[model samples]
Target: MATLQLSGVCKSFGTTPVLHDIDLDIGEGEFVVFVGPSGCGKSTLLRLICGLDTIDSGTLTIDGEIVNDVPPAKRGIAMVFQSYALYPHMSVASNMGYALRLAGTPKAEIERRVEAAANVLRLGPLLKRKPRQLSGGQRQRVAIGRAIVREPNVFLFDEPLSNLDAALRVDMRAEIAALKQRLGTTMIYVTHDQIEAMTLADRIVVMNAGRIEQVGSPLELYRRPANRVVARFIGSPRMNLLPGALVGDPAAAEIGVRPEHVRLAGVGHGLAGTVRMVEHLGSDLFAHVEIAGVEERVVARLDGGREVHVGEAVSISVDADTSHRFDAQGKRMAPAHNDRRTA
Candidate 1:
């Protein structure tokens, strides 16, 4: 295993800048995920680390060795791409051992490594099958097994589960998590899927427009986002942004509250609004409420069934301590007190 580090990394195509002063340190045996919308340069950063793309300006180190000019093969890293790039004619065993064979490893060693990878990935029964004969998930596993046989210091996965069906994606995710635990190898994954980042990463790097928005643990990003963009991006249904003048001292131009934090109140509640819509998600219900004076929509996540219905007048209340204040520029405002309540 190896620790990967990028310092002052910058990349551009022609005159168009894509990454700016990127700095990140990935610990040995840690799983770090890069997540962002398309065109955010998450994949570009990964390619740079894999040595597939040259860096414009920065230093990349792996296990204390500067490797900015190192070729992909010499970097001792393996990349599993979005597409399962398995040779159709080669059997699974041959496919997994092809790299070793090409490197002139002993035939016995190649066979042993191939068999071990097959057992680890549960591909023993399909060793003789070709890519055409395997399911999507199986083909992906073969691709991963091919990487494993190389015994790389670091593994890079670029949207490896994006091609699988929903059920297969979930199953493959669990399998990959278990595989990492068993192998204990450092891994860097790139994906736009927030759930994947939240569930699989030790720390997530949220990027936007070629720049990092925030870096934190899943729950940390969800609970205490550094900015408005991250606050909305990390949560399901997203957080509700309301336009309200500060009611007291240390007030900001706008306030942000999560759906779950907005509670239904009786007549004496803090904010009054008309329920616009309600979505029942089985375990929870989300309501879109329109505050009278504000044009922005406020959402509330209610536990169980709600007694309220659309078009009905409703009052919502938020614990003042839990609200996030934001300036006009969308930057976060620190809470006035440290004793803010949360549910």
Candidate 2:
């Protein structure tokens, strides 16, 4: 019952446009993550959905109602911000119950709801502790618990874990995932971290320059990116792009192969390159090489234990079946058609 739909959504900051012609549908009980580089308007889109910012033009609907003009507080959405935003002077229980109390809920009702949320968040033992006394993770839990007590139709998280350290971010990610399963409420989260998007989202909406580039399950986008920009964005080391001629394709403007897909082979059998640098991460090794005719360096991934020295001669194999072809306009080309031209 918490479905959200945005139709032709547009937003502007003064004269400059920030989001453009956005159209999306989020099903009830689905966890969707918005991911993009900073300044891409993902967080702005979240604000529009939460009613914190008004859209320049679009229809915003929740469930069956048009909520474009609804105030954030009345929109049946609760937002958890990047900052914990807990009141340092307030006890955890008080902070969680404050909203209900302000709404004139009976004291007993407030206590009941707060207790339920606290138990769900495992903050029962810390209910009497002030925010100042809590660790970063506990403060975040209190922030989430505050939203839980409101029982909104949708949960909107704007980089809620970005403030935490790496270890705490991983732990909180698991906690949030469990919360989603327990609540089964529609949740829209925004983050620039691809790992967070990949690990947590049921589906990820990849945005770029105020527009959505692609939307799909994590692996789908990772394996079959719609275009060049997406091909470069989703992966850690990113896909290695080379001129089509490097792969013996005359028609394709570019061909992309993931670092992991680039196999080190015997000399003269694959693309010739000299290793420029090697990054060893204990489990994996990434070798950066300068391939002939390739404008940018190509990176190849290997087992961590492999000893590859800088300036070593190496060749990388990229199979046709595994490579992605893009035309001059940066759009992905059909494999059959693309291969026919090469054949």
Candidate 3:
């Protein structure tokens, strides 16, 4: 495991800047996940760290050693890409130890490392099988085993499960979680999947438009986003935004209420709206209500067994204590001293 530091990091492609002045610190053996939409430069940052690409300007330190000039082979970092890229003709054992063999390692050492990695990944029984003979999940394990055999100081994963089906992704996610506990190595994962970021990361780094938006534990980002961008991105179904004027706060720009915090009330009780649609999941139900003045439909989470029908007229109320207020610039607004429940 290794600690990593990035100071004043900046990068660009020709005239377009891809990463701004970014600074971050990662502790030894910590799992940090980078999350952002496409074109947010998360992958570029990973490439810079792994020596696959040159940093435009910044200091990248690994275990107190500056490695800006280090080659990929000497960086003591192993990266698992989205594509397994396993050689079809080679057996699992040969594929796992390919890097060591290329570096002129002793045959005995390579075999020992391969065997150990296979055992840890539960791939020992399939060592003699070719890539074509294994399932997708098994092939991914082999890719992970390849990285494990190197015993690198840090591991980098760039959406390693993107190619798998939904069920395989979940199963692979569990295996990766178990791997983290078993190996206790520093890991940096990049993904657009919220569940992966929330479950696998010790802390999540949220990026947007070439800048670091927020870095915090999953719940921190979900409950107290630094800005509107983060507030809108962290949750599933997303937080519903209503104009502040509708809630007796004309001074504020908008109020954010999570779906779970929104209540469907009797007609004429609160904001009047029409239910546009209803979704029934196993444990929860969601209603999309279209208020007269609100531009977008507001989503409300209800108990699954509760009956709600599309086109039904309903009133909605937001819990003032749990709701959030934002200023015109999209910054969170503090609650008034006179009322803790009001923003």
lDDT per model vs. reference: 0.87, 0.91, 0.91
Give candidate 3 regions above 4 Å deviation. 337-343
Q: What is the lDDT of residue 247 in candidate 1?
A: 31
* Clashes by residue pair, model 1: none
Which 10 consecutive residues of model 3 have the lowest summed lDDT? 334-343
For model 2, state the Cα shift of residue 297 in Å: 1.9
Between candidates 1 and 2, the lDDT winner? 2
Candidate 2: stretches off by over 4 Å: 336-343
Model 3 residue 122 CA deviation (Å) reads: 1.4
lDDT of candidate 2 over 1-343, digit per residue (tens): 3999999999999999999999999999999999999999999999999999998998999987999999898888999989988888899999999888888999999999999999999999999999999999999999999999999989999999999999999999999999999999999999988898999899999999999999999999999999998899899898999888767786789998899988886577677889999999999999999887888899888999998999999888777778898999999997734332221
Which digits, one per residue and each the tens of the lDDT, describe model 1 over residues 18-95? 999999989999999999889999999999999999999989999999999999888999999899799889999999
- Cα deviation of 315, candidate 3, in Å: 1.2
RMSD of each: 2.4, 2.0, 1.7
Kindly provide the TM-score of model 1 when superposed on the true structure, using C-alpha atoms.
0.93
Q: What TM-score does each of the candidates earn?
A: 0.93, 0.95, 0.96
Candidate 3 lands at a TM-score of 0.96
Q: For candidate 3, what's the RMSD?
A: 1.7
